[model samples]
Target: MSRIGKKPVELPSGVTATVSGQTIEVKGPKGARSFTATDDVTIAVEENAVKVTPRGTSKRARQQWGMSRSMVENLVIGVTEGFKKELEITGVGYRANMQGNTLKLALGYSHDVDFEVPAGVTVTAPKQTEIVVEGTDQQLVGQVAANIREWRKPEPYKGKGIRYKGEYIFRKEGKKK
Candidate 1:
């Protein structure tokens, strides 16, 4: 038995969940989110809680059991509180600013890099060195943060690059003369 799948996801107050065939849709304060599960698992909502079970004893069925349960839980949380990711820039003259719906970044490149913010997600720059990404979908928020960081990854020598707010970069010493 899957430990996570065995536990039903409880519906918070003011949140409603509906299960139709293999699809489950959750509606809450934030918004409505739906997830379609594979035939390897069966999804049901009972007593204001969502439950997922494997259809067979095969490995694929078991795998989908846990994953489906987690996805359902994420839907509940997404429509309620949502997800957020933060990024920080380091280095002299490196900064970020917003232009309308686009985010302009200065990372020691030949020219400023303009990143167009995608729909359904909000990007903000409270300070020149800080970038905040928020959205109802967890994957989208995380992917946006990673794409921004990909522009200038933190180096082991100088650690001069964009990284997550709490990320730690291991410093490397220069060659001995």
Candidate 2:
């Protein structure tokens, strides 16, 4: 039995959920989101909470049991609190700024990178070296942050690059003199 799958997702006030076939949709103060689960699991809403249960004792059913529950929980959280990802730039002369819907990044490149922000997500540069990505979908928020970090991944030597806040880089020894 999956520990996480055993618990039902509680629906907070001002939030509501609906089930249609294999799909579960949740709406809250932030926004609305839905998830379509596989046939390996069954989903239901009862007593102001959402529950997922495996159909059989097979491996795929067991796997989907936990994953479906987590997905449902994520939907609830997404519609309510939403998700956020923070990125930090660590390099000389490196900085980030927002120009309308575009994110201008200076990662030591000859030209500034103008990243066009996608819909359903918001990117903000509170400081020159900090970028904050927020959205109701957790996956989108994380993906946007990763895409920004990919432009200038942290190096092993000086660690000068864009990285997630609170992330640690494993340093390597310098070449012998």
The lDDT of model 2 is: 0.95
Top-lDDT candidate index: 2
What lDDT tens digits, residue by residue, belong to model 2 across residues 1-177? 899999999999999999999999999999899999999999999988999999999999999999999999989989989999999999999999999999999999999999999999999999999999999998899999989999999999999999899999999999998
- What's the TM for model 2? 0.98
Q: Work out the TM-score per prediction.
A: 0.97, 0.98
Q: Kindly provide the TM-score of model 1 when superposed on the true structure, using C-alpha atoms.
A: 0.97
How would you encode candidate 1's per-residue C-alpha lDDT over 1-177 as one tens digit per residue? Answer: 789889999999989999899999899999899999999999988998998989999999988999999999999999989999999999999999999999999999999999999988999999999999999999999999999999999999989999999999999999998
Q: Which stretches of candidate 1 lie over 4 Å from their true place?
A: none
Stretch of 10 with least lDDT, candidate 2: 73-82
